[model samples]
Target: DTAVSQTPKYLVTQMGNDKSIKCEQNLGHDTMYWYKQDSKKFLKIMFSYNNKELIINETVPNRFSPKSPDKAHLNLHINSLELGDSAVYFCASSQGGQGGDTQYFGPGTRLTVL
Candidate 1:
C-alpha cells in the first residue's frame, strides 16, 4: 500500500483559474503538510495540519488554503492561480508534529500555469 497518494499528478492550466489537489495518506500520521517547490527547487512549507487543526506558514499567501478532513488527508486549494505558482506541490506526513520526525512525501503534483 502506498503510504501517501495524490490525485492528478500533473496539472496544466491558464492563469486566473482555480484548482485543487487532493492528497491521502495511510501512514497514520498526526501531522500532514503542503509544501511548494519553486522552479529553483526550493521547497517551503505552505501549511500544516495537526489533528485536523491548521497551522499556516506566515510566508504563504492568503490565496493558498489547506484543509485536512482527518489525520490521513490534506488537500490544497489555490485561488486565482498565478504564473509563479507553477511548481511541484508535495504532500507529506510525519508521525509527530516535530522537527526530527521522518516525513514521507507523496509524488508531487506538477502545476503549470500558462
Candidate 2:
C-alpha cells in the first residue's frame, strides 16, 4: 500500500476555474502538510495540520484552503485559480508537528492553469 497518495495527479484547467486535490496517508502520522513547488523547483509550505488542527499558514492567499478531515488525510482546494497557482502540489506527513521530523511527501499533483 502507498504510504502517501494523491488523487488526479495531473490537472489542466483555465485560469478562473476552481480545482481540488485530495491526499491520503496510511503512515498513521498525526501531522500533515501541503506544499507548492513552482516551475523553478522552489518549494514552499502552504499549510500544515497537526491532529486535525491548523498549525502553519505561510502567507497563502485566502483562495487557497487546506482541509484535514483526519490526521491521515489532507486536501487542498484552490478557488479562482490563477496562472501563478499552476504548480506541483505535494502532500506530506510526519510523525509529529516538529521542525526536525522527517516528512514523507506524496508523488505530487501537477496543476496547469492555461
Candidate 3:
C-alpha cells in the first residue's frame, strides 16, 4: 500500500483557472506538509500542519491554500492560478514535530498553467 498518495498525477489548465489536489497518508503521521518544486528544481515548503497548528510560508501566494480535514489528509487548493503556478506539488507526512522526522512523499502532482 502507498503510504502517501495524491490524485491527478498530472494537471493542465489555463491561467485564472482553479484547481485542487488531494493527498492522503496511511502512515499515521501527525504532521503533514505541502511543497512546491519549480522548473529550476528548487523545492520550498508551502505549508506545514502539526497538532492543529498551521505554518504558512511567507513566500507562498494567497492564491494557494492548504486544507486538512484530519491528521491523515492534506489538500492543496489553488485559486486564480497563474502561469507561475506551474510546478510539481508534493504532499508529505512525518511522524512527529516539524523537525527530524522522516517524511514520506507522494508521487507528486504536476500542474501546468498556460
Candidate 4:
C-alpha cells in the first residue's frame, strides 16, 4: 500500500484559475507538510501541520493555502494561480516533525499554469 498518496498526478490550468491538490497518508503520522519544487528542482517548504494544527508556515503568497481536515489528510488550495505557480507539489509526513525523523513523500502533483 502507498504510505502517502496525492490526487491528480498532473494538473494543467490557465493563469488566474484556481485548483486544489489533495493528500492523504496512511502511515498514521501526526505531522504533515507541503513542499514546492520549482523547475530548477529547488525544494522549499510551504506549510506544516501537526495533529490538525498549523505549525510551520513559510513565507508564501496568500494565494496559497494549506488545509488539514484531520491528522491523515492535508490539502493544498491555490487561488488565482499564476505562471510562477507551475511546479511539482509534494506532500510529506513524519512521525514527530523532528529533524532526524524520516519523511515519507507522495508521488507529487505537477501543476502547469499557462
TM-score of each: 0.95, 0.97, 0.94, 0.98
lDDT, residue 60, candidate 2: 98
- Compare the candidates by TM-score and give the number of the best one: 4
Q: What residue runs in model 2 are displaced by over 4 Å at the alpha carbon? A: none
Q: What is model 4's C-alpha RMSD?
A: 0.6
lDDT of 4: 0.97
Ranking the candidates on TM-score from highest down gives 4, 2, 1, 3
- For model 1, the superposed segments whose C-alpha errors exceed 4 Å read none
User: What is the total number of backbone clashes in candidate 2?
Assistant: 0
lDDT of 3 by residue, 1-114 (tens): 999999989999999999999999999889889999999999988898875568655578889988889899898899999999999999998998656779889999999999
**C-alpha lDDT of all candidate models, in order:** 0.91, 0.94, 0.90, 0.97
For model 3, the run of ten residues with the poorest summed lDDT = 50-59
lDDT of each residue in 28-83, candidate 1, tens digit only:
89999998899899998888888999865748887888888888889999999999
- Model 4 lDDT at residue 73: 100
lDDT of 2 by residue, 33-85 (tens): 99999999999999999999999999999999889888889999999999989
Model 2 lDDT-worst window of ten: 93-102
Alpha carbon deviation, residue 3, candidate 3 (Å)? 0.4
Q: Rank the candidates by lDDT, best first.
A: 4, 2, 1, 3
